[model samples]
Target: MAHPSLTETTARVQEIIGSDAITRIFRDAMSRTLRDAFVHSDGEEVFVLTGDIPAMWLRDSAAQVRPYLPLAADDPGVADLLVSLVRRQVRAILLDPYANAFNARPDGAGHAGDETQMHPGVWERKYEVDSLCFPLQLAHQVWRITGRTDHLDAEFARAADLIITTWQVEQDHAERSPYRFQRHDGPPTDTLTDGGNGSPVGRTGMTWSGFRPSDDACVLNYNVPGNLFAIHVLGNLAELATVVLDDPALASRARDLAAELAAGVREWGIVTHPVHGRIYAYEVDGLGGAVLMDDANMPSLLSLPLTGGDAIDAEIYRNTRAFVLSPDNPTYTRGTHAVGLGSPHTPPDHVWPIALAVQGLTTDDDAEKRRILDLLARTHADTFRMHESFHVDDPATFTREWFSWADSMFCELVLDVCGAGVQSTLDEEQVPTP
Candidate 1:
């Protein structure tokens, strides 16, 4: 099979989607990352900027190019691009596994004033667990979709070890971890509590994360969604270690950690709500403190079906989904323009395009998916591209005019609706649940 050109792919998508306006938006979104956000270095590394930030986020960079994974199977060029990204991510993880974002060069750029163990190559050391998970997920997906193991080289093995050790240390964060962040002259969410140590957390087998995927400080350290994502990615890493690396020890370590995290989530992350029954909590402190509201971020409670894979309870997820999309979840917002999940990172009464896209991708209801897609098209504020977020009442009032991750997610959702969805490796394996 010949690799389809961008033009050919667009035409193929147009057949499924009859509307010309939507087709135009889809084409523009399909090319946005490559044209505006991607930077291929002379040293064969690919750095993807998170749109208007001029910095590469470990999570956003992987997601920005994910919609092109299907093309990578047939196109060597696309496959090479994905491989380069994995290489770059491996280097970034080796540089600082705790850093969420990095500079294209070791230029000492981005938030140097923040009180953390700052490195010249690191853009922001927010220390979100999802930051480490995204790279592994991308590498596994590339190999699964393209049958290429070139990205799973020696450096990746070392990085995988570091990631595992880091998570293990974080499982006992107060005693074993050395991560701290304190930003002066910023919002409260920009810095951690207890002199940058974050709020104290009781020992749960789940790993600790200082920040949410939204880059905001966590009220409670044990982020349920982030740990769920970590469990899924650990399964990916275990498969890679078993099949590609031929290291049974590493595979066993990954599986054991995954089981521990799964046990922690099962014991501490689910709560019996009066209205929603047994639903997953967004964040838990293992000390009877749990936040039930869902954010608009990728690993949010509303996104458990997409990120949590088979480990997620079907009936609980259905109940949780109902609670999150309704007025029950504090962040669930409805206005004149659209109704969906929002984030504390954004202003109040705003809806995130990424959340809308996730809603469309995770649902089996065709009408609901189409409704979310149409809502996204109507709320782009005439940019023909997705933004970070827009006001629920007024679509024009938005933030971050250029966000590549949001655009890529929109493209993925559109492809999903068109029945040409990108394949993901996260759902291929199930984490052992207690």
Candidate 2:
């Protein structure tokens, strides 16, 4: 029972995708990519990418199917599929407590330890708080976007508790937390120490993150941006605990942690910015050590608002914004075609689509948004498919063809162009910060 408007919209989408004309290329590009990336096999989650990589990620898989969530309310086909993806992610979280990515089965074709590959039902063991955090955001959003809360169940409560306990223990990395990892690729610097595992950081009031949101090792324990996000998410979790699930104890726990993370950010995350007066650092040691640069990752300074969090008016966000957009930030780069956030994971001067969209998402200027849209249109290398990162100079030489998150973010950008018309019924269900 497709709504008349959606029926019309789908037809238009099909026509635009089928038309081999240049004017409608972007629309077609998005359509073909969506078909390739969002289609699930054997009643499973959509593969976040194509090629040799074939599996779902807690983060990427949620992102892949998210765009179609609003359509599911009227389209039964999409609704059933969305529910399946949630079940897959819930099963993945339950599969192994510490894993960030998962597969559909144990004998999955992908390598066991590769952080990037997906083995169906087999979660690659990476202890990133972001991994757990994304599912909650996506699950809540899916319900909101489609008026479907069928996915929120007993398992969600347990997963939420696991996240809380993990964070609480990790706040004191010395003896309280029990997490470790060792990557064998990249460079020696990219690899962690103390037997490829990170050395313990001195206990700070803030929770210890073994890795930054980038999945790279944290030089300073309190990743300020992540702490900011923790405040935002933990605040949301506090409400979800009380209002959504009606558990006073869990709500209280979320509140305590939310308040603590905010306090920690204020007391420890801020640093003196000689030019901008004061700014937040990328990471802080709590004992005075701070890494004063930004990465091209979400939960990044630029992505604060994009993650559905409150704005940090602190001078440090402004300062860090300036630094991140400038050549001063190690990861920032400028090129002939475009200038934006880059990352260490990719080649030098490679711009990330996630970073670009975040900037567009957080920017208040319509002109800036349009500019980003055009760059993205041009930067997709005419494939209309978003890549993880592209050479700042050449758009074709990119990485990660099947990144559904980037594609969804690009769709979000297109929606933004038309007044960001994509609304989730879930947004109206916001419980409000108490």
Off by over 4 Å in 2: 1-34, 39-52, 69-80, 108-123, 311-316, 421-434
Q: Candidate 1 lDDT, tens digit per residue, 372-408?
A: 8888888888888899999989999999989999998
Position 199, candidate 2: lDDT: 57
Number of clashes in model 1? 0
| TM-score for candidate 1, residues paired by index | 0.96
TM match of model 2 to true structure:
0.85
Where does candidate 1 clash, by residue pair?
none
